[model samples]
Target: MFWWFERSGEHLRLEVLQLAADKYELRVIDADGTARVETFANADDLAKRQTQLQHALSSQGWTGPHGWVM
Candidate 1:
């Protein structure tokens, strides 16, 4: 799933995808559209990081859909 946000004239994108068995990837696009990728060993860790990012963005006045918990 993917969530999009905008704050201070910049765009943010968060995406989650399953790469393989028990493996997942988190893709984040920063304000300048710089992409960062992280791999998670489990769903729980991914969920935690996703929540953290959501909170951080919300605090910064970002407006978008909340992340989907897998």
Candidate 2:
């Protein structure tokens, strides 16, 4: 899955790819091209982590659109 959002006048992109039956890769990239990556054991785990990040961003005043902005 892939997602994108705009916050604080900046664009951010997230890419989630399945690497194996039980492994996945997540890549977060900023508009400036700086990127961070992480691996997860399963989709459920990834979803949990993503939710945590969303909460953190929201707490920091990062607002998302009603649907996907990308």
Candidate 3:
């Protein structure tokens, strides 16, 4: 899955995918090209982290968790 948020002129994207039987990852990329990747042991942990990230971004004035499956 993929998601994005924008604030002012800055944009951010997040991509989530499974790595293996018990592994998942969330990759974050910014408009300027900086990127970060996080790994989780399972979907539950990945989901919790994604939620936290969304809340943090929202508090910072970013708009839309607008996303679609890839």
Global lDDT scores for all candidate models: 0.87, 0.75, 0.93
TM-score of every model? Answer: 0.83, 0.77, 0.93
Backbone clashes under 3 angstroms, per model: 0, 0, 0
> Looking at model 2, which ten-residue stretch has the lowest summed lDDT?
61-70
- Candidate 2 residue lDDT tens string, 1-70: 6676677788777777888999998787766999999899999999888787667766867675223432
If both were scored by TM-score, which would come out higher, candidate 1 or candidate 3? Answer: 3
| Candidate 3: tens digits of C-alpha lDDT, residues 32-61 | 889999999999999999999999999989
Pairs with steric clashes in candidate 2: none
**Runs of candidate 3 exceeding 4 Å displacement:** none
Superposition TM-score, candidate 3 onto the true structure: 0.93
Best by lDDT: 3
* Better candidate by lDDT, 1 or 3: 3
Q: Return the lDDT, model 3, position 33.
A: 88
What is every candidate's alpha-carbon RMSD to the true fold? 2.6, 2.8, 0.8
The lDDT, on a scale of 0 to 1, for candidate 1 is: 0.87
